[model samples]
Target: MAEQQTWPHHELGRKLNNWGRWGDDDQIGTLNFVTPATRVEAAGLVRTGKSFDLGMPFDKDGPFKAGGFRTNPQHIMTLLPSDTAHTKDGLISADDMIITGLQAATQWDGLAHAGYGGRFYNNVPAAAVNNFLGATRNSFHHAVERLISRGVLLDIARLKGVDRLEDSYEITEADLLAAEERQGVRVRSGDIVLLRTGSYQWFLEGDREHFLGNAPGPCLDTCEWLYEREVAALAIDNHSGEVWPSPIEGVTIPFHQVVIRDMGLTLGEMFNLEELAADCEADGVWEFLFCAPGLKVTGSAGSPITPIALK
Candidate 1:
């Protein structure tokens, strides 16, 4: 096997100049300004099993929390109330009631989403940013069109002899390797590593108490290894990539800062990974992966996504 390549400026510049735009972060979120354009290839969406629902429900007329940056909306009306009424009246609602706010569920944080000190994605300094467009000082130049890439699922559940891994268990580098070794799989660079901790199962069951707690997630060492492996992005079945109330001393989910700032890696949290994992196990081929985040417009984050994989 050959050594994996890193996407740092020097190497990335050479690759871009020679091979055109590749890599996950290259997808700029701004495609099809007025009209809808094809964001993903139809062939890439190969559904093998049941579809996963990655959206979180919002409370209707729920009180807004103090100091909350997002203003949650309530869906009180729908286009069609019932098929009988619609057929009799010849009236069909075109829109469904929905509440839009800061999407905390299955979403991708743009490079501009967060940063420590003064660096954004690609390690670009704050001083280099152009704030005239309302973009932050440490913003990442993304438009969403460049996010198309191959995805890989790491099935940690089957390795544990269960339908899903236990919730609140911190996934360690050892755990990751053990799973890989057991499955005879090797993680490649620039692959979107989707980890199935089985937290999503609990989530779908409406177990809010356990879902919000410290769910199974990857440790900092795993983040470091993924960075070293040049993983373009990472998605997990848990809420955040790092387990909540982090065990790392004197730090608050330092892995997030380290991976985002230092490695310029993108994080995908709150994903529905059960079906993806099971499909891979059934096919005996766990490598072909694909993802296309919802086109972000007039919002900080997007709604849930139904990213799929091929055999």
Candidate 2:
């Protein structure tokens, strides 16, 4: 892994910081935009009564490698039917257990997932996230009931007439605006935008390495656009939510530092958007009710989510 560069982050952080925008004790950050009225309006989008699952399967074949910083889910059968066959009532059952990283599959990154300048969201000290307690501040549980809202799918790949964007393609603000215009939809405040680069097709085709490396996604320049639009959160169909290989020469994932650390924005990754994209294209409807609540795992940095889009 390369060292993270810290040349322009301080200036950018000051420009887009949301430290006290919500409150001094804020934990959920921009998710505060998903108000009750927005959720009620989003529920009105379900005219066809169709739904799409946007989560990838959790198993050993996921994107992460074994013995790495993160590994795929490991399912173990805790109890077998044969073990209970000696019961006099002839009762038998099977039980299983799953051990995996919270972000091994489709997931939402909590505010504590990234930090810089020795602070988390809302100016929380980075030392709050100790090895013993996971994350004492800005944990995933803070956003559990706040993720329900209208979702807009900006299919950049389809906008460019390609099945998938080229590897390391930097999706710009212009591309996002063009997609919204071409799709005949407009992104509004409090909308959770789902950006589709269509790079997850590589993982679906059994190319985990390709799925995790050099993927196409938003560039650092789009962070200001997101802040200005007041987007509650962003989910993308890729491993990282930004273009790989540090588009800024020496900075690794500068978008994450700006968005997650400074802007206090939540991010979702590894979502399977193919089925949802097909449905939207067929019906010519790009907006839907997106209800994906993270698990109430206190102090956890992130949580796996099986996101659902109802149309």
* Model 1: CA > 4 A from native: 1-73, 76-93, 122-134, 137-143, 163-168, 298-304
Tens-digit per-residue lDDT, 1-311, candidate 2:
99965567657778999999988989988898899999999999999899999999988878998778999999999999999999999999999999999999999998999887798888989899999988999998989998999999999999999999999999999999999899999988899999999999999999989999999999877888899999999999999988987778757888888888888889999999999999889989999999999789989999999999999
The parts of candidate 2 lying over 4 Å away from their true place are: 1-6
Instruction: Give the range where candidate 2 is weakest over 10 consecutive residues by summed lDDT.
Output: 4-13
Which pairs in model 2 have colliding backbones? none
- Per-prediction TM-score to the true structure, in the order listed: 0.68, 0.96
Query: What is the Å distance of residue 34 in model 1 from its true position?
Result: 26
Model 2, position 21, has a per-residue lDDT of 94
